[model samples]
Target: MDNMFVLGIMVVGAFLIQSALGFFQIKHFGNEYNELKAEGRVAIGKRAGKLTSGTIIMFLLDDEGVIVRGKKLQGTTILARFKPYDKFKGKYIGAITAEDSEMIAEIKITRNTVMNAVNNYKMFINGEAIPEKGSPFAELVKKIKNI
Candidate 1:
């Protein structure tokens, strides 16, 4: 009879401990969830306005679309209307050819943003950034005068 009583006490103690552990685990998970939610909110709040623009000096493959950096053009259409030296004071630094080759450009970006995302892996030649998606050759040379 004493042995049975001891077993009953032991079983109750074990269940109590297990319940306490489960409650703690739930509390920990809730804290972690709140922290993650706060971080996401902060990140969204930090992204304010548009950054700078520049020719892409390099291309780094990422989940987002191709990034290009260069002398921060003042207007919003700079990326869409990017042409060979036409926008930068009529200075045709160089041109990207259809053939696979190297190129150069005056890459630019926002003061604090990641440079790789702005440059987008496109090699700059003669102060000119070239994107592999729009052109044929992957390379070109920047004119020394344009640089």
Candidate 2:
């Protein structure tokens, strides 16, 4: 009877710990988001949790929205794509688009290929240089660009 009671207490303790951690994480991210919004940074998209260590990095885009791949999104231009590396771990690529370039729409192809598609796709999109010619990632990037 004492063992069972101990086991139940342990479970409850673990649950409370997890809940506390989750609450703090949400509060932290929420404050950061609100600050970004106040700074006029608009979010394009984001990926978080698990692989990202619960780091919610928002892909902040330019208000003007520049073109990258020669395609238009409805009425706004196709600005450069952005992706975060990991929680507080800098980024894989810094700049997605140049200061003043007239490209088109940038495509990020993330499907069943090499590790997590989200990270892989963002790496390609924000990579300093394109992947090598015949590599699988290169092939994926080619297909996305062509489309």
lDDT of 1 by residue, 43-94 (tens): 1000113453322211111222221212221233222221222222221212
Candidate topping TM-score: 2
TM-score of 2: 0.41
The Cα error of candidate 2 at residue 72, in Å, is 26
Predicted candidate 2 versus true structure: per-residue lDDT over 12-73, tens digit per residue: 99899878876775575566556546655433223222222221234333343321111011
TM-score of 1: 0.28
Give the range where candidate 2 is weakest over 10 consecutive residues by summed lDDT.
67-76
Clashes of each: 35, 6
* Pairs of residues clashing in candidate 2: 68-104, 69-104, 69-105, 70-104, 70-105, 71-105
- Model 2 off-target regions past 4 Å? 48-55, 66-147
Residue 102 in model 2: lDDT: 18
Instruction: Give Cα distance to truth, residue 16, candidate 1, Å.
Output: 0.2
